[model samples]
Target: MPKISNQNLFDALLDSWDRNNTILVNLLQAFSHGGLEIRAMEGGPSIAELFTHMHYCRLIFVLEDAPECARPINRQEWASEQDPSVLARLLNESAAAVREAVKSRVEAGQDMLVHYDHPILMLQHMIWHEGYHHGQIKLALKLAGRPFSDDEAGLITWDVWMNKT
Candidate 1:
C-alpha cells in the first residue's frame, strides 16, 4: 500500500471541504427559485429544517463538541417557510466556520494526529450528510418537474485541488 503524507491528507480534506461547499451553494441556489417544496420523508424534517440542522451541526463541530446522532426526526407541524436568503447566509457562515477551524488546527500543529472523535471528522461527516440531503433535494426537484443543473457537481472532482502543489 502506498503511504500518504500528512500534507497530502490535509490537502485532500481541504479539497473535500471546498467541493462540499460548492455543492451546498448550488443546492441553496436551486432552492432559491421558489419552485421546489422542501418536505421531510415519512414524518421527517422538511428541507428548511434540514438546512437549519446542518447549520447548527456545523456550529457544534466548530465549538469542538461531539457529533449529535440523528436529526430532530420530527417535522415542526407549523414551521414558517424559511427565506432562501437566510439559507444562503447560513451556508456561507458555516463554510467560514469550518475553514477557520481547519486553519486553527493546522496552526496549532494538531492536524496530523489521528483523532477518533475529532472535529475534522465531524466536519467531514457534515459534508457527507449535506451531499446526501442534496441528492434528496435533487430528486424532489425532478419529481416536481422543476429544472435543475449539475454544474456544481462537476466542481467536486478531487483532482482539481489535489494537483495544486
Candidate 2:
C-alpha cells in the first residue's frame, strides 16, 4: 500500500469537513422551509434538540480544552430555550471557527502527528459527529411525517458534489 503524506491526509480531512458542512446547510435549509416540529422521541432527540446538540459538540471538540471536552453535556439543556435565529448564528460561528482552526493547523506544518489528541482530531470528529446527527435528524423528520428532502444526502458523497461542476 502507498503511504499517504501529511498533506494528503489533511486534504482528505478538509474534504470530509466540507462535505459535512454541505449536508448541514442542506438540512438547515429544509428545516427552514417549515412543516418541521420539535417533538420528543422515545429514546432520541427531536430535530431542534439535535441542532443544538450539534452546536454543543462543535464547541466541545473545537473550543474546549482536551480534558473539559471529554465531559458530556445534556442535549436537552443545550436545546431548550434556544431561539432559532440565535441557533443559526451560533452554528455559523462554530463553522467559521472550525475552518480557521484547520487553516492554522495546515499553515503551521504540524499536521503530521500520527498519535495525538489534538485539534486536528477534534476537527475530524466534528465532521463525523455532524454527519451522524444529520442522519438522525432526517429520521426524526420522517417519524414526524415530514418530508425528507434529498438535499442532505446528496451532499454527503464528495463525488456527487464534484460532478456537478
Candidate 3:
C-alpha cells in the first residue's frame, strides 16, 4: 500500500484507541480505589484487573505483531487501579506504544515482520477486544452506582471513533 494508505489506516486505528481511552478515563474518573476493585461477578475480573489486562494486551500486540518496536517489561506486580494516577499513566503509555508499533509496521510495509499479517487486522482485533471489555467496565460502574453521564457513554460510538477521516 501507499504511504498515505498506511497513514489512513493508522489514523483509524488510533482513533479507535482514543475512543477506548476516553471511555475508560471517564469510567475510572467515576470510581475510587475501592470501587475499581469491585468485580461485576465472582467469575470475572475486577475493574482494576480489566484495566491492567487491557494495558498488557496492548503490550502483547506489539510484542507479537511488531518485532521492530521496543518496549519495556510492564510488570503487573500490583493492581494498577488501586492508584488512579498510576492506572491512568500506565494505560496512556501502553496505548501510545500500541500506536507506535502499529505505525511502524505500516510504514515498513512489505518489510514488516509478518509473513501473513496486516496491522489493520491487529488493530481491529485490539479495538474489538477492548470493546468487549468496555461493556464490562460500563456494567461494573453501573453496578457500583458510580456516576457517569450519557455523553461519556456515547463517546465510544462509531461516530467518534471513525469520523477522523
Candidate 4:
C-alpha cells in the first residue's frame, strides 16, 4: 500500500478491530452464557474477561490521556452481554472514542502518553495492543476446546485490514 494518511491508518485499525471482533464473536457464539466464563488454562482470563479487557483498555486510555475526546465511549461495558453482536457493537463504540481522542490530539498538536510527540502512534499502539489481546483470545478459545482455522487467522492479518482499490 502507498503511504496512508494518519486518518486512514486509524480507520484501518478500526477495520482490524472489527474483523478480529467478528471472529471472537463467532467463537463465543459457540458457547453458552456460563461458557463465556470458562478458562481451561489456570491463570488466564476467560473469554468474556478478555473481551471486556479489550474495551477497558480503550476506555482507560481515553480517560487518562485524552479526556477531550472521551465522550463517545461507554466505559461501563465490562460485564458480559448475552449477544456477541452487542458486545461487538460496544467494542466498536469504544474504538471510535479512542480514534476521536487520537484525532483531537493530532489536531491540537498535543502528544500522546504512548508514543511521545506523534499522536498517530496512539493508533499504532492500540492496533498492536488489541491484536495482542486477540491472539490471547484465540488461545483462550482453543483451550476452551473451540476449533480454529485459517479463516479465523485471516481476520487478524494486515492484508485483510488494509484498504483495497
Worst 10 contiguous positions by lDDT, candidate 2: 65-74
Indicate the TM-score of model 4.
0.71
lDDT of each: 0.60, 0.61, 0.69, 0.65
| Tens-place lDDT digits, model 4, residues 38-155 | 6648765766777777777778788778877765544555565445666676676777777788777866888876444576666667767877876776677687677456665554
lDDT per residue (tens digit) for residues 1-165 in model 1: 456777678767776787677667656666665743455345656666666676766665555432222122223333334777777776777777767676566656554233435546756777788778777766766655663655543444333334454
lDDT (tens digit, per residue) of candidate 3 on 90-161: 878877777787777767674335532666666677777878987887787777777446775565454555
Model 1 — which ten-residue stretch has the worst lDDT?
Answer: 65-74
Measured with C-alpha atoms, the lDDT of residue 11 in candidate 2 is 71
Model 1, residue 140: what's the lDDT?
A: 63
TM-score for each predicted model, relative to the true structure = 0.65, 0.66, 0.75, 0.71
Candidate 3 lDDT: 0.69
Superposition TM-score, candidate 2 onto the true structure: 0.66
Q: Runs in model 3 with CA error above 4 Å?
A: 1-10, 32-34, 75-80, 111-116, 147-152, 155-165
Clashing pairs in 4: none
After superposition, candidate 2 runs with Cα above 4 Å error: 1-12, 40-43, 65-77, 81-85, 109-118, 149-164
Question: In candidate 4, what residue range of length 10 has the lowest lDDT sum?
Answer: 154-163
Cα error, candidate 4, residue 32 (Å): 9.2
* lDDT-best of 1 and 2: 2
lDDT of 1: 0.60
- Candidate 1 colliding pairs: none
Clashes of 3: 0
